[model samples]
Target: DFPPLLISLGDLRRGFVFHEVKQVLITDEDIFKRYRERRQRWVGEEEKKIERWTELRGGDYVVHIDHGIGKFSGIKTLKLQGRKCDYFQVNYKGTDRLYIPLDQLDRLHKYMGDSDHPPPIYSLEGGQWRLTKRRVRKAARDLASSLLRLYSIRKVIPGYHFSLDTDWQLEFEASFPYQETPDQLRATHEVKQDMENPSPMDRLVCGDAGYGKTEVAMRAAFKVVMDNKQVAMLVPTTILAEQHHRTFRERIAAYPIRIEMLSRFQGLKEQKDIVTSLKNGGVDIVIGTHRLIQKDIEFKDLGLVIIDEEQRFGVIQKKKLRELRSSVDVLTLSATPIPRSLYMSLMGVRSMSMIVTPPKERLNVETQVAEYNEE
Candidate 1:
């Protein structure tokens, strides 16, 4: 094989004659390795830029670690103690201003709360910020203690260990229309492993909208059904529950599993019959909105509970979910998880799997904002 040839664009443009031609035997693999390393470094730098909260604009709300929330006026240069320095000007409630030194930027953070409802600016003289911070710290402590207690209880309680995959499970997976992505495969495997273990499975599967998170849940639900246990899928809205019901029925049409949907859209008698069927173990899978968690609804032998868009549920619904977590396996799916769920996953308090790879035919969604015009 001939070695690769190198030519400089500057040399070619200058109309210079080359004294000699040299060739080096560098493989394509080496060039690709260097390219990958540089790409990774660039990606890391971009992530760091995103993580930093230094891009503050005027009139934006900001929160200080020492003080409470305030409105960022602008940056100003002032002389203090016989020295000139730049400080951030923040306006609090009622004509109050606090100047923060540039060196102490770490204490400033951009407010990340709901934009529709802006937070009230705190007055520095009232000392109310201190009291608010104290209450927040106490709430955090209580949450941490409760989480620890739940973890300890789950560790000791005996949970059902599912058997290995059967022939029917393999066939069901093979029937999927599209090829599975690597991340999807890994997440499915981890979920199955968790179910097979003695501990009650509490795995969070996070993926983008079209990353096949539903497929992972389907596999888990099928596994539970194969073991002669029922599955309950909870969604936030009735529309989503109906959509999931259709998808699940279409996917498992070849199997003998009975899937039912419970939503407000159904007639009162229809809903009552579905509830009755669920209690008698006639339904293998039930998909519904918050109605499924009502006091009257009961399952024969629930093995797994799948929660979709968990952030949309209210506190009471989530409390009911927590109660279910103590007994049945819970699989949570979220495109954008809430801070609490993300925190638990990061701290290893709960098993988490991320499917970051998008499917082949998925397209990027273009978002546009337009002024409303009544016609």
Candidate 2:
């Protein structure tokens, strides 16, 4: 191949090749200096990473394919060619030793396992198994892509149109059992702005459980429904959908909103009837577990989609949801971060509203820990 463009493409000099080219284009000296500074900072960060890897030792949780998650017992030193090399002694599976080299620390991660987490072990020398894993991962990615395409098509399709009015707002607010908290009010304002704005809304409402998140969602749903549009409430669990359906029915009972649920628990006849109603604008709001995403279900005027407990959704489900809500506005409510890595990657691109303050009535509980004998 020809010499790289960075080097001169001319005749050879006394000891080097030279070429006549454009002058240095460093017009902004400040920008050039900043670029260099950033590059140097990244280099320093990489050096720190390498230093950390080299000095890794005991008490650290190391993840190995065969050993899974285990605490480093200590290091074993071996003298080879007058130089000493260290190996990490990881304790796993009842005295199981995983001799990982200090150099390989880059492959490990700090294990932050929860109560339900199962210890992972090292699957060393399992090349065939890894290949199988790769194939499975690839298949899953392909399936997700297909589902996303379908969702995109659905989102682009225009659904129901809504009219702007404060009647539903007044009715819903009057029916609210408790006064709205400051966080709830802020979230409500954000959702309302998203719904009223001509541009499609894609907002995430993150907060702890029982923090009036559902109420905020209800307010948005009511607004959408009042606009002569349909709302889709997508939940990750059947139980949650049922709960939401009941809550929506109860909250909007004072209004003329017709909310329905479509889940596996319902018979085929019920699902069919609900789908028909959705297509004919008979149902004002439809709430269901991921079942709401099925191809058979059609929304007459799907204006807003509220995703509850979004962290419970898998990569495929979240992708599918995104596609379905591409054109329409989406409101995602979650306790923690979204489970899908894709959403995290696109966080800056998406709108997010966090309810950090707890409701007025909710109080923080203090806990006391003591020895059993002391009690």
lDDT (CA) per prediction: 0.86, 0.71
Global CA lDDT computed for model 2: 0.71
Runs in model 2 with CA error above 4 Å? 1-61, 64-73, 83-85, 90-107, 111-163, 339-347, 363-375
Candidate 1 vs. true structure, TM-score: 0.77
Over 1-375, each residue of candidate 1 has an lDDT whose tens digit, in order, gives 433555332101112333464434344444455444433433332111213335888899988766889999888988766778888899999999999876666567778779999999999887899799779779879778877777788889978899999999999999999999999999999999999999999999999998999999999999999999999999999999989999999999999999999987899999999999899999999999999999999999999999999999998898788778887899999999988998889989888999999989889877899999898
lDDT of 2 at 324: 66
Residue pairs with colliding backbones in model 1 are none
Pick by lDDT: which candidate is best?
1
Q: How many residue pairs clash in each candidate?
A: 0, 16
| RMSD from true fold, candidate 2 | 10.9
Writing each residue's lDDT as its tens digit, candidate 2 over 1-375 gives 443334332212123223455233222333344344423433322222323654556666665442346676777886666777787677765545667677666445565556475555544444543565568669878866865665556446653344554865877687787878899989888888767766677678888887889999988888887678888998888888888889889888877779899898899999999999999999999999888887788777788888887778876787678676668888888887654423642555456777788777887666799778954
RMSD of each: 16.7, 10.9
* Maximum-TM-score candidate: 1
